[model samples]
Target: MAIEGPFWRAIAVFRVASLVYATVLMAQYRGYEQPMLGWLVIGVMALWTAGATFAYSVRALRRWPLPAIDLLTALACLLASPYVQGAGQGAAGTLPVPATWVAAPVLAWAVYGGRRAGTAAGIVVAAGDLWLRIREPDVPIMINGAVLLVMAGVVVGHVARLAKQAEARMQRAFEMEAAQRERERLARDIHDGVLQVLALVQRRGRRLGGEAAELGRLAGEQEAALRELVSGTAPQPEGATDLRTLLTRHGSPDVTISTPATPLVLPTETARSLAAAVGAALDNVRAHCGPGARAWVLAESGDGTVTVSVRDDGPGIPDGRLEEAAGDGRMGVARSIRGRVAELGGEVSIVSVHGQGTEIEITLPA
Candidate 1:
C-alpha cells in the first residue's frame, strides 16, 4: 500500500494535540498526589511527542518498530495513571495522565495496518483505561471515551485502506496508457521505414525474374508477416466483423475454405483471434505436409457458438510426434493455436491418424 505524506502529517498533528490536551488537564486539575512526579511525566510526554513527530516524518523510520513503540508508550502512561493521579482520584472526576494522548497510537495503527490493527489498538487502550478506572464508581466518561476510540479506529482505517487502493489503480492506469502510446509510436516507425522498403524490394525483384523472382516471393511473404505483426500490435477500434468474410479471404487455389453465405458477425477482436488461430493451423499444414497438399476449412455457427475446422488430406501426424515436438520446445500447436483460442474463451482439439489425414478443430462462443 502506498502511504501518503499527508497521513503522517495528520498523525503528527494528532500527537501535538494530545500532548497539549494532556498538559492542560494536568494543570487544570492539579490533583496529583505527587505534583513533582506528575510534572516529570508531562515533561517526558512532551519530549517523546516531539521525537516521535520527527521520526514518523522521515519515511524510512515509519515502520513496525515505531508504531509498536508508540503503542507501548501510550499503554505505559495509561497503566501509570493510578500512580500519577493517585488511587480513587479518577473516581473524583480526575482525568488520566495521557488523556487524549491515547488517540495517537490508535491513529498510527489505523494508518499502518488498516482496520484490523486499528481495532486492536483501540481495544487495548480501552482495556487499559478501564483497568485504571475499575475501582471508580459511576465512570461513564471513561466508557464513552473507549467507545469513541474504537469508532475512530474503524473509520480511519477504512478510509486509509480505500486511499491506498485508489492510488494503486491510478498508477496502473497511467502505466497502461504509457505502454499503449509507445506501441503506437513503434508501429508507425515500422510502417514508414521497414515495411515500405520490403514492399519495394519485393516488387523490383519480381520484375527481374529467375532466382530474383523466388527472392521476391520470400520478400512478399515477409512483408505480409510484418503487416500482420504491426496490425496486431496497433490499437483497434470498437466494432464487429463478419466472420465469414474474414475466413473467406484465406481461401487460395491450393486451400479450400467453406463458410455460410449469410454473414456471421462477431466482435472484431474475437474474429481476428479466431482467424489467426486458423491461419496457424494452415501454416502447420503447409510446413509439415507438402505445399501441394489439399486442405479444407469449414465454418459453422449455431446455439451461441462458432466452430471452425481445418482438415488436410496428407500423411497424418505419427503417434507421439506432437509430444516430441513439444519436448523440443516447438510450441506452434501450444501457443499459436491453443493459446489464441483459449484467450478468446474457446477450445482447440486435434485428431490425426497415420496415413489418413490430420484435422484441427476450434470451437468458440459467439
Candidate 2:
C-alpha cells in the first residue's frame, strides 16, 4: 500500500472524533445569537466531514485544489464560531465551534505537500482565528493554540516526507534483488552451455600442436574474460562501503594498513574493484617477494578524489619486465590492476626499480 494511506485514515478519525467533541460543546454553550442557524452550520460540518473523508481516501482527489478547498472550509467554520456561540461568549475565551476540528486541513496539506505547505495552511487558519481577536476588543488570542497548530503541521509533514524516502529505498532494494536473481540465472545458463564448450576447445586445441596451441591460448583468454563477466560484480545505485575496511583485512605482521580517522567511503562497486586491484598487487608480492616480505597499504581521500597506495619492500620490477610479461600473456599488472582502475575512471601509477621497493598509487574520482 502507499505510505499516505494510514495518514489519511488517521485524519478521517480525527475529524470524526473532533466533530463529536464540537457537538457536545455546542450543547453546553447554548446561548447563541441564532441557535437554529448554529445547528444548521453543525449539519454542514457533518456533511463536509463525510465528503472530505471520501475525497481524501481517493488518491486522485488529494491534490492542491482539494486541500485548498478544505482549508477554506475550515476557515469558514472558524469564522462562523462567533455568530454561533455569540461574540461576547467567544470574548470570554469560549472555544470555537469547530474546536480542534480546524486542524484537519493542516494535516491534509502536510500529507499533500510536506512541511512548508502544512505550515502555510496552519498560518491561514491561525490568521482566521486571530481575525476574531481583532474584531472583538475583549477576545484574547490563544498564542499556545496557534503555535500548536503550526507545530502539528511541521511535525506531521516531516514524518510524511521520511516515510516517502524509506518507501523509495525499500522499493529499490527489491528491484536490485530481482535483478541479481535474473543475473544468476543467466550466468548458470551460460556456464552450462557456452563456457563448457570454450573450456573443451581450449583443452583440445592445445593438445593438437603448433597452430592449434595458439587457438587454444585465444580460447583460454576468452573464457577468462567471460567468467569475469558472469561473476556478478555490477555497480549498485545505492549504499556505500568503506575502503578502509577492505584494506584492513590484509593487515598482519608483514602487511600494514594506514587510513584516515574518518571512513573512506566509496560506491560499493568502486571500493570492491579497487580492493581487488590491491589484492592483485598483493598476490604479485606473494609470488615474487619471499613469504617474509613486508607490504604497506595507505588510503586517503580529499578534494573530490580517493587514492590508495600499496607499497612493498621487496625486489622491484626489472626494466621492461611488465611489457615482456604482457607479451607472454601473463597479465597480472596489465589486466587485473590496470583494467579494474580504468573501468572506475581512475588512474594507476607504478614506481619500481630493480633493487628498490615498489609503490602502486591508484587515484579515483570521489
Query: Cα lDDT of all candidates, in order?
Result: 0.82, 0.84
Candidate of highest lDDT:
2
Which residue pairs clash within candidate 2?
Answer: none
Model 1, total clashes? 0
Clashes of 2: 0
lDDT by residue (tens digit), candidate 1, 86-129: 75466555778888898888988998889889989999988888
Q: Give the Cα-based TM-score of candidate 1 against the true structure.
A: 0.67
How would you encode candidate 2's per-residue C-alpha lDDT over 56-151 as one tens digit per residue? 999888778999999989998888877776644554547888889999999999988899998988888888877876777665656777888899
In the order shown, the candidates' Cα RMSDs to the true structure are 7.8, 8.6
